[model samples]
Target: MNAARTQTDRTTARSPRPRAVLAALAAAQFTVMLATSIVNVALPQIRDGVGLSDGATTWVVNAYGLAFGALLLAGGRVGDLLGRRRVLVAGLALFALASLAAGAATSPAALIAARALQGLGAAAIAPAALALVMESFPAGPARGRALGVWGAVSGAGGAGGVLLGGALTEAWGWPWIFHSVALATAGVLVAVVVCVPRPPGGRDEGPAGRFDLLGTTTVTLALTGLVWGLTTARGAGWTDPRVLGALGASVLLLLAFVVIERRRPDALIPPRLFRTGRVAAGNVLMALLGSVWIALFFFLPLYQQQVLGSGPLATGAGQLPFAAANMLGSSLAPLVARRIGARATVTGALLTEAAGLLWLSRMSADGSYLVDVLGPSVLVGLGLSVAFVQLTAFAVDGVPGKDTGLAGGLVNTTRQVGGAIGLAALTTLAGSVTAASAHEPLREALTAGYRSAFSASAAVLAAAALLALFLTRAGAPPAVPPAAPAPRPLTPEPSRAP
Candidate 1:
């Protein structure tokens, strides 16, 4: 009895507390997302402080995104192979160091380089953290609830970054944004070390195979080229030879990646994974969702600050209603999914968001926040939160345990890539519309441009809603097959005869 009691104590000690694990993972996810948007409000100050030109100012944001998106696949795979805890710890260390470097930098080059490094760390952190969440929770109400929390934090991070950035920049200048992230990241790292448990058999117990170096290289370069080309097009125009060349090279590299994945036994992304229809369809919908989501954050702030003449603090504060609504929707998503099914929930959410965007597109130059922004913001926030949760569930729904990291990486990659492309395209369109309306008042012209982008985003979301209808049927069961009935024993027949 003493031995058995001792063994139970040992098992209990070894097992990680679920709440602690969830908190650590969620904190990690929030930090990575915070890095993405925290700098937007501080960009002008950063540009002046670091002597950045207009072009260089833009790179301060794009550099992080490009690196993050490009390396996510490799980062996720590395976590899966090398150990999630190990990769997560390393990523947190790197992210902290990079944030310090960024904060201390006096030159544009140093700052940009540090931001890129931060992105690399973020790439590793996001997927590993998400995979750990999946690993920790079994599928059912528990996982659904966990994912709802994930979705809430993820959505909150975007808005929260803006709110925090504005406050930090206002109180202690722009460098404090980086400094704050570093400090928070260090705390999260410590929590992860204490709370997160290693897998059985040790930290290195992954599939035994050579790393797919060729596939990794090809895909990374391809994503880099694609993002670079799109980012350049926003400022340099699509016809620029540099942009054209980058796009062309990216296409070729992507084709090569496809070929390499098919031929290689240890591919970065197995071709067979696409055979799962949900995976493919889910990613497509996620891309469309991302296109609108990213642009919404970008344009909303500009509209508040530039068109409405709001200060940075006020602009950030204005997003509270939206953020609150988003959190509420995220918390409610699982309950709604249980009632209506994930597919139908996603479809309804998309349509709801589209309606909100359509309403936003009708904003006037002389509009008030309550009339023009608040109501629509609530609608969009609710819809966006729910759609994000359902779509995330769809993407990783039937993936194998070993490839959970890969699945996380793929979903993240599509969203980031789609955001980049959509931002560039929408920015260009808005710029053109604004220029064409030169005869109007400056505020009016700007409003028109913003309105156009909102309308376009609404159309995109509508299309996604339509696509969701065909992709997954309502009330469809999980991909797991039903268990077979047990066989009857021969002795049972003799007993019946007797």
Candidate 2:
């Protein structure tokens, strides 16, 4: 499938250009998501470096999710309006510059702003990369394989991000995490401009459709307000007037955005897309799966730190199985999907994820990685492999070429938004329960928070299972036509009639 896309992506990509293009595009996805996970393993250092509280520090993470989530559809649309290759190049340059700025930053506010800009760049790059793959490959054996690689990079990027961050932060400090990424960004930016081929259409020279300004503003504010309220409400009470106002305003803003979308001719997301049962199911599942992933990474690291009493390096060690397992699963997904179909692969995946959640929930104070984490890690890895590929295929399935960007953005948007919502809700749940407990202040409270996040993650994965069941059609392979009946050997009567 990837080969087919490679063949179609451009005249330039027909031979050696394919390998270069794939590597650069994959590298682009890997690097951007790396920023999400890389800084995560260094949160303690980041907090101290910026002179911020743990609660304030969480915003550094959420800002990326919020901006990336809200602007994703628009970004995808922009790529379609302009060109995927062009937007990708521009985004890469912007991203590299942002990474340099982030690394040089000395204050929390500066880091937060830098991360937001990074998210904006990522928003442009992600959908463009995926759409380019989709536009290149036809739906069949080849597309599935390409999607498998695409899924793996996304799923494994999180694990690799944290691992890379841990190594860099320990050796070079938190700022170097951003610095290391900057170096890659600079290299990849050059590669993209040089190696990545332009789409068949040259560039979108169609009429400039009106940008959905009102929809953009409302959606961004709605998501940002909601994430802020939920993140902060943990430290301040939910009823704290500021938190309440923010949460309330966010809800109102979202409602307004929905109303605007329904009325707009050039809606970022058309109303009918939601009505497509498959697209709707796939979008919902992506969001839930995203929530599971982001929340797990957030709390699991805490488990090693506060619960298991590990430092950053030790936390990185603890993630070894998860990182390795995800990598292994990702590596094998394309081959497996080709042998067995994407439908069966994804169905099995969601179920396995639910089981992994149940196993992970068994974590205890005395738990070891072998007993408490390894099996679940492998299962979650497998699930990620299946879900990521299937969901990407699911979103763009049967969408018109003109709406390809919208299709890609819809799935990616679900993921980022789900993560934001998941983080807010999961974090709030943990904080609220911990605060109400009669235990000594911090550690026990945080433990309760971790459990809250885990349990919520499990629930979201469970919901994902249900959504996948409904969203996917039963037959992944189309039915073959019956063979024509064999002719009688040299029938003289039939020959005469003919």
Model number with the top lDDT: 1
lDDT of 1 by residue, 1-498 (tens): 999779657766666678788899999999998899888878899999999999889999999999999999999898878777789999999999999999999999999999999999999999989888877766667777778889888888998888888889899999999999999999999999988876544443554566799999999999999999999999999999999999999999999998888899989998656655377777889999999898998899889888888777777888888889889999898888887767778999999999999999999899988889999999999999999888887777767777777888899999999999899999999999999999999999999999999999999999999999988773445321122233221110101100
Q: How accurate is candidate 2 locally (lDDT)?
A: 0.72
Off by over 4 Å in 2: 1-16, 199-208, 272-277, 331-343, 436-448, 474-498
lDDT of 2 by residue, 140-207 (tens): 55555566677777766787777788888888899998888889999988887766554334443323
| RMSD (CA, Å), each prediction | 6.6, 8.4
**Model 2's TM-score against the true structure:** 0.86
